[model samples]
Target: MAAKDTKNIKLAKQIYDALSTEFPDSSCSLETDCPQNLAIRGILSAQCTDKRVNITARQLFDRFPDMESIASQEPEVIAEIIKPCGLTASKTKSVMAFAKKMTDEWGGVIPNDVDALMEVPGIGKKIANLIVGEVYGTPAVVVDTHCKRVMKRTGITDSEDPAKVEKDIMKAFPEAQWISIGHLSVDLGRKYCTARAPKCGECPLSSFCKRRI
Candidate 1:
């Protein structure tokens, strides 16, 4: 193989190995019994902590267990239920609109296609990628804050834009490793490679990480 191809293979192996060792049971944080709920939860998670999203989603789901109920509800009511997650006004609109779209257009089902999912309000590229990957078992790079930051520090990507970072990661790693790599990067960011004061000494990729600061 060429030098670039060899490097990509090596990086893919290293990442998979490290992630398996670090977070063997890793998965998305948003709790949901169904894939549609998981997609809705992921949308509500924007600008909000996963804990708060889980709590609010539980309460909201109790009253509105399906797309029809959520679509029928007023945005203000939804906002009140999800106030703890912050960005309530926008999130409420997004959720309500998303629910309506799913009910009317999607036949009360979340579409497995990323493009179709993105057509809904509040479902951006990152969240759409995540939904497709987690719910539909499609391989994709779900670039979040953690993945963007860590990928930059590790010299895997230079852009902070989630879309650009996703492209960079896809180029660096193999298709099979894309989903788990995002999860692993988030774990590394939360545990050792933090933004403010990264614990580089404890990081498995410390030697390979370009950012020592």
Candidate 2:
């Protein structure tokens, strides 16, 4: 590799180690045990907070009970159940479609491949990576909004698009650190690197962060 690229990778590792220490045991905020449940929760999380998604997920599961029950429900019913998470109509379609696909096509098996997850409606690269990393224990860079903002401010990437940010992170850090980086960045993003008027002075990464304005 070029000398400049090599230096960046070394720097990235330093940042990773620091953040990992600061936010040990970091993980996806969405609470779900099963892949199918996680897939549904991810769909509900778009433009929504993890807290709200988790609350709505409990209500949804209570009403529907299982994947087969969810697949059999009318779109209207699903929408009504998840209305608190917002974008009810679209989220409902995505959840139902995903459930049906899992039931009819994969025999209730969640695909470990990103492309396969993306085939489900509302399952974008972010959710796909989350599922693969969490459910399948695979290396994945889940560039959600918090991840995108924190990585850019930390001088990890110049791109704002999630796909590009994911690429930059993958290149800068080792595969084993990919999943942990996402969670650590998110924890930092929420506590110190907030979108507006970030608490940079108190941030652990402030010393090295570009602090892009």
Candidate 3:
């Protein structure tokens, strides 16, 4: 490995240790009642908050009860229930597609594979990683807005692209940490390294964060 790359690895260890200590309880904010339900919540979580997703998902599940129930419903009915999540027309299609996949294709099982999960409309790379990592304990990096911002600020990656940020994270952290690192970055982003006004003095990574900006 190049000398520069080796130095970055050491930095990764320090940041990982500091974050692990500062946010030991870091976890996915999205509610996970069941694999299938969590998948549905993920579909609703685009551009939406976790609290909202949880509430909306509960309402959806209460009315439909099962994947087959959701699959059988008219698209308009599903849209009405999930309208609060925003992107109603598209989200409705994704939700119904996932439900139908669950009932007819996967035999009521949500797959651990990222590609399979992404086959459903509106389930992109980030959500796919979330579903596989959170549901199946698979090692995957989810590069959401918080994670993307935190990573760039901390010098984990110079690029702003989610795919590139994910690559940098995978290189910096080991497979064992693949899941928790994303959650930890999110915690840091929310509590300290916020976009507008970061709390650097209180941030655990302030000591070595390259941009402290």
Per-candidate TM vs. native? 0.93, 0.96, 0.97
Error of 2 at 178 (Å): 0.8
Per-residue lDDT for 88-175 in model 3, tens only?
Answer: 9999999999999999999998898999989999999999999999989999999988899988888889999999999988988889
Per-residue lDDT of model 1, residues 89-148, tens digit only: 878888888888888998876788888888877889889988889887799998988888
lDDT by residue (tens digit), candidate 2, 33-109: 77888888989999999999999998999888789999998788888889999998889989998999988999889
lDDT of model 1, residue 105: 94
The predicted structure with the larger TM-score, 2 or 3, is: 3
Better of 1 and 2 by TM-score: 2
Give all candidate RMSDs, comma-separated.
Answer: 1.8, 1.4, 1.1
TM-score, cand. 1: 0.93
| Top candidate, metric lDDT | 3
The TM-score of candidate 3 is: 0.97
Rank candidates by TM-score, best first.
Answer: 3, 2, 1
- Give me the displacement of residue 51 in model 1, in angstroms: 1.2
True-structure Cα RMSD, model 2: 1.4
Q: Rank order by lDDT, top first?
A: 3, 2, 1
Q: Count steric clashes of candidate 1.
A: 0
Candidate 3, backbone clash total: 0
